[model samples]
Target: MYVLKHGIKRNPEKRWALPDRIFFGYGACAILAGAFLEHPSLEGFYGERIIPGEGFSGNHIYATNGVIAFDYHGYSAREQLLEHHKRGWASRNPGWHCTIATVDFDLLDTVELNRRKMLGPDQYLHDPVPRARRFLRRIDHAEGAARALRTVTRSQPMLRVACTSDPT
Candidate 1:
């Protein structure tokens, strides 16, 4: 209270705008920031997400049902949970899956399909830089799926050489 009186700070704006208007304005800007923050985690948290029509993205847990040109489409997180067929289970058999029960929550089917297919969506190879790649780079530094793809492409030749028993 003393600082408010004595400090050289500027006086606050005292216009009589409706509180609701301020609330709505802040709310809208927050939503927009979440929607297009470039980071998947940030964007997902801020915006309503839906899977694009092409289908599941290997890296993005929040794919929308329809595609927008860019910064135009949106979807809810619930849609992503449903379409992926994500499930909850341990590695009861071989080295197969990521044990999605921890992540899938309750909405999706959790079908025990091919593990690789689950980690990577159908359109994963179509572009040099996929949306999921950017999303991954923005979210987690450790297990970004896009980075994982690059590793695979770079190491494929080395792996084959090792498998073929090359001298060096």
Candidate 2:
């Protein structure tokens, strides 16, 4: 689950699914920022292998937002996005604060688990692993990440204090 905070909104439906495709959108940077700033272990998750060339010529722009191991283009794109985001945010809001995290999930698997639970208690009680999985399950991974962001902010009391205090 990777929450995004940007200057513009692209998707009108807002209920986006996994493997969502957005043409000429800045969503890639949000994914990359999460991988870079927090989950270095899951950088590959941030990089999207598919590219849609028909709509936007800037399809190549997101190549760098992934890990080099998964896709070199994405790795480079991620670097560019990170630098650009930091610089841009700094210019606009000198005291800009942010934290990023992506909670990778298998949507189909989650749905299946939920279905099993709904069918019978025996299905869920059969395994402790299912309980763990259910605990982590989220209706929307990005929204889950947004919840995590709140948890993060709440846990860091110092961060709250620092945010309010004058830098000088």
Best candidate per TM-score, number?
A: 2
Candidate 1: misplaced stretches above 4 Å?
1-38, 41-73, 77-100, 104-116, 119-125, 132-168
Reference-based TM-score, model 2:
0.26
lDDT of 1 by residue, 20-118 (tens): 223112112122222333444322232222222233321223322121111212222232232222221112223223211112221121232123222
lDDT of candidate 2 over 1-168, digit per residue (tens): 123444233443342321322311233322332223333333234422222223321121122222221121222223333344444554555555433222232222435324422112122213323332332232244453344445445544322211121122
Per-prediction TM-score to the true structure, in the order listed: 0.18, 0.26
- The lDDT for every candidate, in the order shown, is 0.25, 0.30
lDDT of 2 at 101: 27
Best by lDDT: 2
Query: Could you tell me which 10 consecutive residues in candidate 1 have the lowest summed lDDT?
Result: 159-168
